[model samples]
Target: MSPARVMVVDDHPVVRDGVALLLRNEPALVVVGSAESGRAALERAAALRPDLVLLDLRLPDMLAPEVVSGLRAAVPAARVVVFTAHGDHHGVQAALDAGAHGALLKDAAVTDLVAALRRVLRGERVCDPRMVRDEDASRSAVARSGLTRREYEVLRLAAQGRTNPEIAETTGLARNTVKTYLQSALHKLGARNRVEAIGKASEAGLL
Candidate 1:
């Protein structure tokens, strides 16, 4: 059989290059294309029609959920396997809701990542087994915060090292709108900035 055609989508050039390099040695997997953002990913998918897409959650032009949607629409034959730094949370749920086949945390060993890709290509649903569990649920912090669902989403992404423009691209909001939401979230959490807000959210089990 021909090798399984695969595409990678990530905003980070090093990540894209690394994944490509790793797959280059796999006898059954071929790197059909790679893109640096959601729109570019869609555009390339339209042409390459790869068998799988290793999708990143924080893209420069779109969120993981939206990227999943666009990839499915653009290439129905291609399955999406979310390759992200984020652990299981509302963001992962949203990606699943958007029709992703599987998810793998970025910290997984390269061998494990490769194995998960093969499993997902075989039509199995897989996610990070060592998922981050909610260790604490201090409702008091949340009660004191009064942050909305959107605010939680925004904060969660911010906690994952996403910049404001990246958050806007991922969340499909204007850059200014994302900044405003971030400010509001910070205020609600009594956080002086994004880092503090993220810490508060983690303590509240909102991450």
Candidate 2:
């Protein structure tokens, strides 16, 4: 098989270059590109069409989930993996909900990063072990929120930065139907807007 084409995005030159260098030495991966900002990341990703993206949560211009959503919109087929120093479950959940394929802490061993890349490429939803422990909490919160599966589906699509129309197309539902579900989800989450709903859901582990 050909090596996986990868891109690195981080505002910090040190981290970005360090990660690029690490991936460059791997025979199974190729450093296809690198970007130091969110805008650049999106532009380069669209042009380079990488198979995977190693992204930082705190970019100079955007947060993790926003960057994840932007990357997803820029390259629908490319897998985004948040490679960050932050390990908070809320942030991790937000990234995953926003269409990230996986997340890894900066402290991860090179071997672990390689393993995660391989696993995610193979279609596994990879997460650092620390983030997995919060699943039960998120499940409980989701249960308590009382969102129906359909509503949850709409919410997840919204969390990924989809508009009502986009969510309608994705779920094969009408625009009104998507709006209704989103309204109900907002009510349940006590959120005023789509952004608030996504943030609340991520914090509650509902996403």
Candidate 3:
């Protein structure tokens, strides 16, 4: 059987090279390409037609969902698996919802990473055990907070110090809509203000 053709997509040069080198040592996997951003990944995927894509959750120009959607659209046959440092439910859930086949943490052992990739190739949906546990634990918190996905998204941006206008622009929502979401988040979190809301959300693992 032919080795699985894999493409590594990460913005960090060292990580991209290191992952490629590691994969090259595996007899069943071949490192066919690498990209530093989501756009580059999409462009390369169209040409390389890799059997699998090892995608990072956060890129310089796009988030996991947009990148996953683009990659799937660019190469329908390629299986995409998210490799990220972030284990948060929102990010992982977004990637999965966008059609990622698996999610693995950056701190995972190389053997585990390789095994997960192989499982994905064999048609299994894999998520890191730690992430699963965290997700499970936080599920109730998320429900209790009554924080919708969009509300979490807006709050996350606010936590990053993005102003309402900036959040509106980034989310493509009207300024009034952005304010509404923030207000709703604050109310749901029982927060007195944006700062309080961010703090509460972070503590609840919503951010």
Q: For every candidate structure, what is the RMSD over all alpha carbons to the true structure, in angstroms? A: 7.3, 3.8, 6.8
Leading candidate by TM-score: 2
Q: Which of the two, 2 or 3, has more TM-score?
A: 2
lDDT of 1 by residue, 1-207 (tens): 898999999888898888888877888899988999988998889889899999987676555666787788788988998888867454565567578998888778778888998998999988887654443433344455698767767876676556788889999999998888889999888889766676566555564
The TM-score values for the models, in the order shown, are 0.66, 0.69, 0.68
In the range 1-207, model 2's lDDT, one tens digit per residue, is 899999999888898778877777799999888999988998889889999999887666655777798988888998989887867655677778677899899999889889899999998888888655466676677679999889988987776667888889889999999999999999999999888887788666565
lDDT of 2: 0.83
> Model 2, residue 5: displacement in angstroms?
1.7
> Over all chains combined, what TM-score does candidate 1 have?
0.66
lDDT of 3 by residue, 1-207 (tens): 999999999999998898887887799999888999988998889899899999987777666666787888889988999998977656676578668999999888879989999999999999998775466655677777888888877876775456899889989999999999999999988999986776567656664
lDDT of candidate 1 vs native? 0.78
Model 3 lDDT, full chain set: 0.83
Better of 1 and 2 by TM-score: 2
